[model samples]
Target: MAKGTKSTWSLRRKLILAAIAVVVVLGLALGLGLGLTIGRNGGSDNGNDNGNAPTPTGSPLPSPTGKLPWTPRVNDTWQIILQNNIELSDDATSVTPNVSVFDVDMFDTPKETIDTLHRLGKRVLCYWSGGSYEPGRPDSDQFQKDDMGKELDGWPGEKWLKLSSDGVRTIMKSRVELSAQKGCDAVDVDNVDGYQNDNGINLTEQDSIDFLSYLSNLTVPLNMSLGLKNAGDIIPSVLPIVHFSVNEQCVAEGECQTFHAFIDAGKPVFHIEYPDNAGSKLKEDIVQNFCGDTGDASGSGGFSTVLKKMDLDGWVEYCDQSVETTALNSTDQGS
Candidate 1:
């Protein structure tokens, strides 16, 4: 009976041991399964940056800690071609006339072209209309019907936009975001001067000031610069935040003095004068008529002026009589 009791006790101990061993094995399997499941669900709680985050694509644009935005200097030379995309060979080492900055249509220009320009040590100013709606733009439909006003004079299929509309502001913000994404050094926001036109929206100078302030807030954090395009009346209000002024025909309209506030504030005035005789190389007299820094060109002493045709094609002539025609892929839209 004692021997039988000893054998029974040994068998009970084995069974207990086997049960404990099986529990241990099952607990380990459950722990491993939970670990893998958490990992698969992006719930890893390791509390460490394991470098497994999803990588982002596209060019590295400005962040809160990225490099400061490019600031253009007074009297900096520049070229603007809005009619089409500027063509550049991938292997080419230089651009024509080799100016310091090129303001091209943001949508029309390819990222490769902007990259090429950067490789050539040139800054790019992406152009987009902020206060006007144009058909055929990718974001054109995004604007509400009530956000549009009368058609812009001389610009077919383009209409003035209400500067106060939230939808309009949203679209403009996206355009600015696009400029930053494209690695553009600055953005030339055009048609902010709708207050000066017979816009159906009755936009006032105060509206322009508020709109520019809004744009400044977006651009400053993105490390991109903002430019006021032909909104001279509100210069004093917005000049502190605006980095530059893209004044069109200021020399012709006796308004260079007004836009020269940018120059006086240590900012650039990228002045353009559209001459009727700009299709070909301008004569010395015609050059003097616009670049003389007197009469209509008064207060343009420090302006970085360019002579172009009314259509703003690739043909450009500088004050010093130098001319260049940027090669284009020949698309029919402005960015």
Candidate 2:
């Protein structure tokens, strides 16, 4: 009777072990099938894309190769000081008003300042002339005389460049490379509206479109963002490639509607309005005129607006009626 019991127990143990092995094999097969399905779909149901998802129609442009560039979102707070480089000590831990991004002159801004801003958790947008020739830039002499066009009306020593010129594009490529080297998160390409201005080179809207594409080619590989500066007419053409819009006086000119497309596209509009008394204390009406949501300021609801001096100095007034001046080194530079 004891021997019979032992035989029965051994058979039962074998049966249980075989059942466990079958369950383990089934789990492995199910996991493998799920992994292959997720791989084919480019992402899992958890909403994380593995860089293989299909590019959606009308989406913000992605880089051709390498990692994607920084994309500034709608209404992201910012401060732009193009007149001079910011003043930040190496050991400092904070900046005034504590904005998310700072736009400074690319050539005037030292690498050390950019590094410090990064340490303080702020991104830097290096400002440079993409469609114009400025006299004192380090690459000023590299611009071919044939590429130089008519002088800008109010900005002295700066002339529009032929957007189609190969020489101009080469110089711009170098500037983009320099921006990458300086730890700049993005580049603000100014004067792209040369097509609207009296550009002597007969720059058409198509020229601006092509030029931005060329710039995108250079900026994308470096993992740097690019911004459109007041070229609202070509927004439809270049919007996919650019990450933001550095609009000047859209509120004052009643053209804020044209730039709202960036906001709609999930990109920021770094709007700047130079009120009459912006250099000093601003009056209530002036603030309302630029920052109010009604009338001229309609469709500008998500703009990152800043009331700055015409000179674009350090003093900045936000839509909240709060004013702050960024500290700057005495060394000044032209835009």
Candidate 3:
């Protein structure tokens, strides 16, 4: 889920909005109509691609403008905190389990934090909410009133974005740009499941596909990896562009199998199961429903699972009941 609210933060964006719009529309048109795109789902190439655009056949665009930082491997162990910014007080490379990656907020986390992780030999996955507009963000003013749809369920101060808008995709691309600038190895975009919610904009699954592919233009050429956060339905068409999957509560929702195709294709599904509210932990038996052998098969053997609190923080409990909290000087943001 979001970090502060449900499963979802800040970055002041200052760019030529008008230029971004033109670039995105033209690039999307060309990729859909003419070019030979490079990436593909490599597995389970199912689903008629949104029908609005054909399966991409050319190189991605708005093409990467610069160099990329890193790419995560399949089944790489990782940790994420989207709702808060941290002030780390210890060596980043010394954490237990020697997890290979860390996913944190874009603006909230200082660039030095990302630098530290790099020094530790760990890759950083920058996280941001691409499907919702949050208040008080750096780019808050960039959103036109109609650009925001219904408020996210239980996630106050956030509203589903009009993903189909040229402006929205432009802003989202800037976020990925921000991630690369901050030295993030990959981008973890959330709330893409907007089509499944009662989002006031009437946003459809096609809107997400178009938006996600456009965002990839900036990542692929730079070599930074991309991840789909919890929009399993579009996987068949989008699998090729993304490097991994960051899912929320699939086992609890009995939808783990929906993402197994990623596994079959040799991609990692960074799975999270949160059965408790913040400041609490799930009972051991209940935890097994997500982590044990009998649980969701997509995550059973190859999945990288983490038992976390609803508000993702440093506190973490693995399936084996092994608990650890990465060293931090501070905690949760806007909770």
| Model 2 misplaced stretches (Cα beyond 4 Å) | 1-66, 331-335
Model 1, residue 163: distance off in Å is 1.0
Over 1-335, each residue of candidate 2 has an lDDT whose tens digit, in order, gives 99999999999999999999999999999999999985554322212121332211232344454245556666678998988778889999898869988999999999999999999988889999999999989989999889988999998989999988889998999899999999998999998889898888899999999888888878876878788999889998888778789999988788998998887776789999987767666787888888877899987888899998888878888888888888888653221
lDDT of each: 0.82, 0.82, 0.73
Per-residue alpha-carbon lDDT of candidate 1 for residues 152-220, written as tens digits (9 for 90 to 100)? 999898999999899999999999888888888889999999999999999999999888888877886
My TM-score estimates for the predictions, one after another, are 0.78, 0.81, 0.76
Candidate 2 collision pairs:
none
How many Å off is the CA of 3 in candidate 1?
Answer: 99
Q: What is the lDDT of residue 327 in candidate 2?
A: 80
Candidate maximizing lDDT: 2
Alpha-carbon RMSD, each predicted model: 15.0, 10.0, 19.2
lDDT (Cα, tens digit) per residue for candidate 3, span 1-335: 36554322222122456678889999999887554332333112313211222232332642234323244545678777665665554464465436888888887998888887778777888888899999988998898888988999998989999887888878887887788788887788889889999998898999898878877877776556788999989999888777679988888787888787777767778988876543345577766777764555434566788877777877777777676666554634312
Taking all chains together, the TM-score of candidate 2 against the true structure is: 0.81
